[model samples]
Target: MSMHMEQTVQPPVDHSVSYPKFLWRALRAATDGGPLFYGSMTILTIVALLGANAWAKQVVHGMAVTDMTDHVSWGLYVANFTFLVGLAAGGVMMVIPAYLYRDDDMHDVVIVGELLAVAAIIMAMLSIVVDMGRPDRLWHLIPGIGRMHWPISMLTWDVIVLNGYLLLNLHVCGYLIYTRWLGRTPNPSWYVPFVFMSIFWAFSIHTVTAFLYCGLGGRPFWNSALLAPRFLASAFVTGPAFIVITLKALRARSAFQIPEGAIERLLSIVRITALINLFMAASEVFVEFYTGGSHTASARYLYFGLHGHEELVPWIWTALGLNAAAAVVLLSKPLYRRPGVLVAALVMTFVGVWIEKGMGLIVPAFIPSTLHEIVPYVPSATEWIVTAGIWAFGMMIYIVALKIGLQAMSGRLVRSDLPPAVGAVPQEAE
Candidate 1:
C-alpha cells in the first residue's frame, strides 16, 4: 500500500473568547496585585470616601460653604481643572514619538500615557463639576438637552474637545487591550488614525482651555496671546516628567521592564520643555512688568505684593523656585542619571507646573476684582478635602488601568480558553 494514505490536518486553534470573558479576565488581572498595591488602593479609597463626604456636605449646604466670593468667584477647583487639562494634553508627547516616529520602545508604553490622559481628563471634569456648585446644572452643557451655544461659547468648545479627547483615548486603550487579550494583533486602521487625531485633539483641549481664560477681556492677566503656547510648553514638561517617574516605578516594582531608552527620551523631553516653559514664563514676566499698564496689576500682585496684600506673593515665588530647581536638576546630566534624583526632579516639575497653572495663574487674575478692589481668595478646608479626594480617585483609576495594561502587554492576561500565546510575546527593552 502506498503509505501516502490520508494525511490528517490539524485545524487552527480558535483562541477566541467572548467579550464578557475578556472583560472578566481583565478585572481579575487588575485585582491581582501585591500587598503594596492593596495598601495603596485602600488608602486612596479612604481618602476618596472622605472627599465624597465633603462634597456631599457641600451639595446639601451650598457654594457658600467654601471660601469663594463674588469678587473671586473661581478658586481652587477651577485652578485644578486648568492644570489637569494641561496634564491631559501633555499625554500627546508620548503618543507623538510612539506612533508618529515609530518608536518601538515608546510604542510599548504609550498606552500608559494615554490611560493617564483618561484619568486626568476624568479628574478635570470632576474639578469642573465641583466648581459648578450645582453639579446638576451640568446638564446645561449638553448640546441637545441644554443650550451648549456652540461656536459662540468657548466653554462649549472646551466641553466638546475634552469629552472628545477622553473618548478617543478610551477607544484607543480599550481596543488595544481588548484585542491583545484575545491574543490578536490590533489592526492599525482601527486605532492608528485615532491616535494621530488625539495628538491634535490634545492640543485643542488645552488651547481651548487657554482660550476660555484669555477670551475673557475682563481678565487682563488671562488675555495674553502667549497663554496657549505657555500652556502647551508647560504641558510637555509635566507630561513627560510624570511618565518618567511612572516608568521608573514600573521598572522597580513590576515584572514589565520599562526600557531605559524610553525614560532617557522622556528625560530629554523634560529637559528641553522645562527650559522652554521657564523661558515663556520669563517672557511673560518681562512683558507684564515692562508694559507697566493697568493689566500688569495682576502680574504685579502675583510676583510682588500690589500694596499691603501679599497672599499670592509667596505662592508664585514658591512655584518659580520649584520650577527653577527642577529645570536645573533635569538639565544636569549627572543628577538626571541618578534614579532617585530623576524622580525628585520629576516630582518638582509636576508640582511646580501644578502651582504655576493653578494658584499662580488662576487666583491672581481675580485678585484685583473688576472694580479694581483688592480681594484675595484662599481655598477652604472643604475645597482641599474634595481636591484630595478627586486626586485619589484618579490615582485609583490609573493604577487599575495600568495593572490591566501591563498584564495584557506581558501576554499574561490572554483568552482563558487558549494556552499561553506562543510567539505572541512582545519584545520588551532590557
Candidate 2:
C-alpha cells in the first residue's frame, strides 16, 4: 500500500503594517539593546551634546573664535569633509560584488555597507554646513530658492552628487529592509536599477570632490591629474577596512551571522586597494620631489616643512607608517586570519587614511600660501569639540540604523509579533 504524505502549508500573513507603525517598530528595535549598546549610546550622546555646545559658542562669537585665518580659511572641518566623502563612496565596493558580480554572500550583507555610506554622507554634509561658519548661507545652495550656480560651479556639482547619492542609498536600503521585514523576496525592478546607478554615482561623488580641489588653479598642492584616482583608491581601502572590522564585531556581539566569505572578500579588496593607494602616494611623491619647482612648496612643507614650520611633518609620517603597516598586515594571509590582529590592522588603516586624506592633504596646501607667506593653520579647541561631536552624532546614527537593520534581517521586527514565514506575499501599506 502506497501512503501519500501531505506537506503543511503556512497561512499567508498580512505582512502589511502602516508606515507609521513600521517606523515605530523600527525605533523600538533601535532603542532596545544590551548594556554595552546602552553604554555606547550614552557616551555618544554626551559627546554629541558637548559638540553642540561648542558649536553654539562658535556661532555666538563668530569664526574669529577658531584658529582659521586669512592664510588658511579651511581647517579641520574641510579635512573631515574630504575624508568622509571618500568613506561614503567606498561603500560602493560592497555593492559591486553583490549586485554586479552576483556574489550571493555579499548580497546578504550589502545593507551594512549601504547604511555606513548613508551615515558617512550625513557626516560629510554636516562638515560642510559647519564649515560655512554661518549656517544660513546654505540657502544659497538650495535649489529654486538660492542661486545655485549649477553646471558652472564644482561646489554646486558636489551638493548635487552628495545629496543624490544619499537619497539613492536611503531608498535602496529602506526598500530592501522593508521588503525583508514583510518576508517577501524583493522585486528587482524597485531597487536594481538604482543599485546600478549608485555604483556610478559613488564614483561621481568622489570624483567631483577631487575636482573641487584640483579645479582651483591657485592650489598647486591639489592640482594633480592623479587626485581623483588616488581618492578612489584610498576610499576603497578605508571603506572595506571599516566594514571588515564591523563584520567581525557583529559576528561576536550579535545573533547576526556574517558569512566568513564576505569578510574574506572585503579583506581581499582592502589588500589590493591599500597597495594601489600606497603606489599612488609614492607616484605623487616622486612627481612632486622630482619636478622641484615653486609648485613643490606645498609638498615640501608637507613632508619636510617650509620656512621652519614643521607642525605637519610628524603627522604625515605617522599616517604613512600606519598605512604601510596596515597594508603589510592585511597582505599577510596568516596574520589576517587572526581576528584580533585583523581588527587592529583595520583600525590602523582607517586612522591612517583619515590622516592622509584629512589634515595631511588639506592643511599643507595653505601653509606656504599663494604669495609665499608662511602662515600655519592649527585647529582650535572649539574646532576639535565640534568635530568630535559630529563624529559622535554620525556614529549614533550608524549604530541605531545597524540595530534596525539587524532586526529586520533576522525577521524579529516584522508586522506580526510571531516570526514571518517564508514566501509571504508582501502587502502594500499606506
Candidate 3:
C-alpha cells in the first residue's frame, strides 16, 4: 500500500493590493465626511487656483514688470523664499524634542510640524520659481543633462539639499500617515532612521539658506559671520512660536487632544531662542556702531537716520520692542500660564521675527545699494497680490495636510483588519 498522503495544498494568500483602491481610501480619509474639512479644502483650492493665475501673469510679463531694480537683485520673492526656508527648517525643533527627548505630547503632534515643513518647503520652492528670471529653465538643475556643478557652487548645493530634505520628510511623513490610515501601527524600521537623518538635514537646509545671503561679500548687511547663528536662533524662536499658535487654534476647536505640556514646552524653547536672538542682535549692533566704516553704512541706515532716510529706523525699533515684549511675556510666571496671553506673546514674537527677517532685514540691506545711492525697493501692487496669493496657497496645503493627519490620528482613515462598523466612530485611546 503506497500510502501517498493526500497533500492538502494551502491556497496562495492574496496579498496583492490595488493602488487605486489605496488612493480612494486615502482620499476618503482626508475628506473626513465633515463639512468643515470639505469647506476649508474648497476655499484653499480656490485660493491656490488664483495663485496659479497670478503666476501665469508673472511668467508672461517677465521679471522687469516687478519693482526689483538692478541694485536690489532680490526683491519680495527672494526675501520670502529665505524666510520660508527658515520656517521649514524650524519644524525640526518639534522633531528633536519628540523623537530624541521622548516627549510623548510632542510625538503626538510632531506630525503637524512635519506637515508644516512640507508646506513651507513647497512654498519656498515656489517663491524661488517666481523670483527666477526664467522659471521655465529650472529643469537645468537636474543631473546628467544639466550643468549643476557639484560642491563647487553653493547655489547648486542649495538646490540639492532643499530637494533632498523635502524628499526625506515626505517619505517619513507619508509612511507614518499611510500606515496610520491602514489602521496599523507603523513599523519603526520604516521611518525612525529617516527621522534621525532629518534632524541634521534640517540644520543643513537653514544653514545653506543663511549662506546664500551671507556668502555674498558685496552685501555688507549679509556679510556678518554671525548671520548663520542669528538665522538659527531666530528660526528657533519664530518656528516654535508659529507652532504654538497653530496648536492653540487646533486645541480650541479640533478634537485631537493636544499633549498637556506641548505649548509649555514650545514656550520654553522660544524663551531660550529669543534671548539668544536678542543677544546676537545686540552684538551685531555694537560691532556695526563701534567699527564705523563704509560697510557699516547699511547698518546705520537700518537703525539710525542715514541721509534723512529714517523710514526703516521706526520699523526696526518696533520689531525690537515687540520681540523684547514677547520675550518678557514668555518669561513671565503668570502670563505664560494663560493660554490667551501665551498666544498673544507668540503672535508678537512671530510678527517681530517676520519684520526683522523681512522688511527690516532685507529692505535695509539694499536701501543704499553698493553704489551709496539710496534706491529704495518697495513691493508693487502686483507684487503684493502675488505674495498674498502664494501665502493663501501655502496655508491651503498646510490645512489639507493637517486634515489628513487628524483623520489618521482619529482612526477614521482606512484601517487594516480593524475597520469601524458602518458609520461608527473608532474608540479613543483615553
Candidate 4:
C-alpha cells in the first residue's frame, strides 16, 4: 500500500464535535507549552539586544569602528543581506510548487515559506541599517521627510518594493488565517490583489538587489546581466533547503504529521534547483576564467587562491565540492528519497550556498579595486555575533509561525462555537 493510503486508514474514534472545540484543541496543540520555544525566544532576545548594543556603539564611534574601509565598501553586512533577500524570494518558488501545481502534499508547508519570507525581509532591512555609516539618519528614506530620492536610484525603488511586498504578505496571510479563525470563509476578491502583487514583488526584490551591485560599472563581476538571474537561482535553492529542514524539525516535535510522499516530492524539487544553481555557478566561473580580462585576476583570487589572502580559497573550494556532492546526491532518486540522504543534501546545500553567496558576492567587488589594490577582510567577533543573532531571530519566527499555522489547520483553534447542523424539537411555550 502507498504511504498516503496507509496514513489515511484510521482507527475508530469519536467523530461528532463542534468546529469551535476542534479549533480550540488545535490551538492548544500548536501553542500550549515547550522549552524549545521558550529557550529559542530567550536566546534570540539576548542576542538581538547584544547586536543592538553593538550597533549603537558603532554609530557613536562612527564607521571607523567597522572593519570596512574605503576600499572594501561592501562587507559582511551587505553579504548577509544579499543572502537573505534571496532566501525570502524562495517563498515565491514555493508558490509554484504548492499553488500552481496544486500539490496538496505541500499545502501545509507553504505558509511556512511565507513566514520565512517575512522574517528574512526583517533581517535584510536590519542588515542594511547596520551597514550604513549613519543608521540614525534612516528616516531620510521615508516619504515627506528630509530627502525622498526618486527614479534616480534602484535602492529607493527597492526600499519601496521590499516594504510593500512585506505588507502585502502580512495582509494576505492575516486575512486568510483570520477568516479561518473566525469560522468564516475567505472572500475571493481579497486574495486576488495579493496573488498578483506577490508574483511581481518576488521578482522585484532580488532583481533590484542585483541592480544595486551591478549598476556600479567599475565592478566587473557585478556588471554582468547574469548576476540577477544568478541571485534568483541561488534563492530558489537555499530557501527550500531551509524549509525542508524546518519541516523535518516540525515532524520530530509535534502530533502534526506531514504525509509520506510530501518530503520526497519536495526533495525532488530541491534537487532540480540545486542542479540549476550549480550550472549557473559553473557558467559564471567559466565566463570569468576563460575570458581572461582585468576581472580574471579577481576571479582567480576567488577560485584558486590569492598571494597574501589565502583564507577564502580553501573555503570556496570546499563550498564548490559540497555543492557538487549535494547535487549528485539529490539527483539520484534512490538516495534523495532516503531521509538520511535528504537531510544531508539539505545541510550541504544550505552551507554551500551560504558561503557561495557570502564570499562570492562580497570578495569579487573588492578585487581589481578602483584604486588597484587588494584588500582582505575578516568579520570581527561583533559582526559574527550579530549575524548569528539575526539568523537565530529568523529561525525563531519560522518556528512560531509554524506553530500557529499547525494549530489553525488542525481544527484545534476556533474563534467561536457554532453548529453546522441544528436539531429542532417541538415544545409548548408562552
Candidate 5:
C-alpha cells in the first residue's frame, strides 16, 4: 500500500459543509454587533461622506469655501495628518521587544499594530492630496513626466521613502497574515528584507518629518539636532499608549481574555517608554533655555508664552505635568502591576502625548515665526469636520484589520484546517 494510504486515516470529513456558515460566523464575531463599534462606525461614515462631498464642492467651487487662508495654509487637516502618521508608525517601535527579546505575547499584536501603521500612512497621503492646490497635477512628481525635485529637497526623498516603507509594511504584514489563513509558513528570505526595511522605515518617517521643518534653517525652533531624537521619544510613548488602550477595549468587548500577566507586562513596557519620552522633553527644556539663543526665545514663546500667542502655554505646561505624572505612575511597581492603574497611566500618556506632540510640535515650529510675526491660525469648522472624518477612517481601518486578523488567528471565517502559520506567505489558496 502507498505510504499515504498506509497512514492511519483520520475520521471522514464532510466536504459538503457550507462555506458561508464559516464565513458568517467569522464576520459576526468581528462586527460583534456592539453599540460602540457600530455607532462609532455610523457616525464616522456620515462624517466621511459629508467631508467627501464638501471636498468635491471645494474642488468645483474653488478653495474659497473653506477657511484656509495664506497665513495658515496648512490647517487642522494637515496637522492631524502629521500626528496620525507618527501614531501609525507607533507599532514599529515594538519590533525590538518581539524580535530582540523573542517575546511571543507581542507576536500576535505586532501585525495589528502594523496594520494601524498602514492605515495611518494612507491617511497621511490622503490629507496631503487634499491639501494640494493642484492635486490633479500631483502626478507631475513622477520621473518621466514633471520636475522630479531631488537632491535639493528632503521632501523628494521623503516621498520615495514613505511610499516604499508603506509598501514594505503591507507586503510583510499581508504575506504573514495571508499565509496564516492558508495554514502555511512564510518564505523567510522575502520577509527578512521587509523586517529590516520596516525598522529603518519606522525611523525614517519621523526623521523625515522633523527634517522637513528643521532643515529650513529659518525655523530656529525646529533646527535643533535634538529634534529627531525628540520625535522618536514622542512616537515611542504615543504608539504604545494607543495600542494598550485599543487592546484593553478589545478584551472588554470580545470573548478573548487578556491575561493579567500580559496586561502587566505591556503596562511596564509602556511606562518605561513614557519615562524616556518625559526625560527627552525635560532635556530639551534645559538645552534650549541654557543655550539662550534665537531658538531658546522661540522655545520660551511656546513653553511660557509669546505675546498673546501664549494661548497654548498653560495648556502645554499642563500636558508636560500630566506626562511626567503618568510616567511616574507607570514606573511604580505597584501601579504598573495593577490593571486599573495601568489603564489610567496609558490614558494619561496618550492624551498628554497627543497634546504635546500634536500642538506642541507644530505650534512651536511656527512661533516666533521664521518671519518673527505671530500669525495665529485657528482651525475652521470645515477643518474640524474633516479631521473627525480622518480620525474615524483611521479607527475604522484598524477595526476592520483587527477583526480580520483575530478571525484568522481564531480559526473562524475562511480559516485553514491546518495549524496557524506565523510569518509571511501567499494570500489566495489554502
Candidate 6:
C-alpha cells in the first residue's frame, strides 16, 4: 500500500481586502515586538546618527577633511557606493531561482533578498550623498527641477536605472509582503511580470555601474571589457551566499523553515560563479602584466608596488587570498556540508568581494594618475565613520525587514484561512 499527503491550498485568494490592515500590522510588528530585534535597531540607529554628525562636519569643514584629491577624487564613499549597487543588483539572483526556476522553497523565502535590495539601494544613494561636498545640490539631478542632465551622460543614465530599479523592487516586495501579511496568496498577475522585469533591471544596474567606471579613459585599470562580466560574476557569488547565510540564521532563530535542497542549490551557484569570477580576474591580470605600458601602471600599483607606494598591494593580495580560500572551501562537497565551514566560507566570500570590489577596484585606478603622479590614497577618519554608519543604517533596514519576513513565513503575524485539505477518498461502493 502507498500513501500521499498534501498541504491545504488556498483557492483564488483575494488579498486586497486585508492589505490596508497589513501596513499597520507590519509597522506595529516592526516595533512592539522582540527584544533582540529592537536591540539591534537601537545600535544601528546610534551608528547612523554618529555618521550623520560626521557628514555635518564634512559639510562645514570642507573636502579637506578627507584624503581625496584631484588625482584620486573618489574614495571610500564612491567605492562603497559602487559595491552597494552590485549588492542591490545581486538580489535578483535569488528572485531568478525562486520565480523563474519555480523553486518552491526559494519562492517562499524571496522576501529576504527583496529586503536586502531595498536596504542596499538606500545605502548606495546615501553613499553618493556623503561622498559629495555639495550634497545640498543633489536636487540638480532632477529632470525638470534640477541639473537635468540625461540621455547624453552615463552618470545620468546610471541615476535613472538605479532609482528605477529600486522603486520597482520596492513595489514588488511591498505588494507581495503585504499580501502575505493579510494571510493570502498574492495575485500572480500583479507581481509575476514585475519579477521578470526585475531580473533584467538587476543586470542593468551592475552593467551601468561598470560602464561608469570603465568609461574613464583616464583610468586604464577600470577601462576593460571584462569589468561588467566580473561585476556580474562577483555579484552572483556574494548575493546567493548572503541569502544562504540569512536563511540559516532564520532557520535557527524562528519557526520559519528553509527547505532542504535550498542551501545545496545556493552552494552550487556560488561554486560556479566563483569559478568564473576567478577566471576573469586571472585573465585581466595576465593581459595587464604581459603587455606592459602606461595602461598597465594602475594594475602594477595594485599587484606589485608602484615606485615606492605599495599601500594597496597588501589589501589587493588579502582580497585575493580570501577569495581563493572561499572558492576552495565551497568547491569541496565534504567541507561544504559542515555548518561551521559553510558559514565561514560565506563570510569569506562576502568580505573578499567587498575588499576586491571597493578598495582593489577603485583606489588603484587613481594611483597612477594621467599625469604619471602616484598618489597613495587612504580613507580619512570622517570617511570611516560615515561609511560605517551607512552600513549600520542598511543593516537596520535589512534586520527589520527580515524580521517581518520571518513573521510572514512562520504564519505568526498573519493567519491565512486556507481552504481545508482535500484528497481522493477510498471507496468500496460502485
lDDT of 4 by residue, 1-430 (tens): 1112222332332324434554565455445556766676788878877777777787887767667777777788899999989888887766665666667777655677777788888888888888888877899999887577867888898898789878877776666655455445556577746856786798899999989888888888778888888888888888888877877876776666665556666666777888888898889888988898776766777876566666578768888888999999877878877868878878998888888887777766786477768777777776776777777766666666666665454433444454321221121000
For each candidate, the alpha-carbon lDDT, in order, equals 0.87, 0.87, 0.79, 0.73, 0.68, 0.82
Better of 1 and 3 by TM-score: 1
- How do the residues 93-116 of candidate 5 rate in per-residue lDDT, one tens digit apiece? 556555556666775566656877
On a 0 to 100 scale, what is the lDDT of residue 376 in model 1?
81
lDDT of 3 by residue, 1-430 (tens): 0012243443333324634555676665555546665676677777777767877887898767678887776777877877788888889889999888888778878888888888889988888888887787887888988878788778887898899889999998888766555545566777888999999998998898888778888888888889888988988887888888888777775766677687778878999999999999999999999999998888998899699878778778988999999999988879877757878888888878877887777777886888888876777766667776778889877876777776665565664556653433343211
What value does the lDDT take at residue 325 in candidate 2?
96
lDDT of 6 by residue, 123-152 (tens): 999999898878889889998899766787
Q: What lDDT is obtained when candidate 5 is compared to the true structure?
A: 0.68
- Please write out the lDDT profile of model 1 over residues 72-190, one tens digit for every residue: 99999999999999989988989988877777788778888999999999999999988886787888888789988999989889999999999999999998888677766666778
Worst 10 residues of 6 by lDDT: 421-430
Query: Candidates sorted by TM-score, descending order?
Result: 1, 2, 6, 3, 4, 5
- lDDT-best of 1 and 6: 1
Choose 2 or 4, whichever is better by TM-score.
2
Task: Give candidate 3's TM-score.
Answer: 0.90
TM-score of 1: 0.94
Per-model TM against the reference:
0.94, 0.93, 0.90, 0.87, 0.83, 0.91
Error of 2 at 149 (Å): 0.7
Error of 4 at 193 (Å): 3.2
User: For model 2, where is the 10-residue window of minimal lDDT?
Assistant: 1-10
In Å, residue 308's CA in model 3 sits off its true spot by: 2.1
Alpha-carbon deviation at 126 in model 1, angstroms: 0.3
What is the TM-score (0 to 1) of candidate 6?
A: 0.91
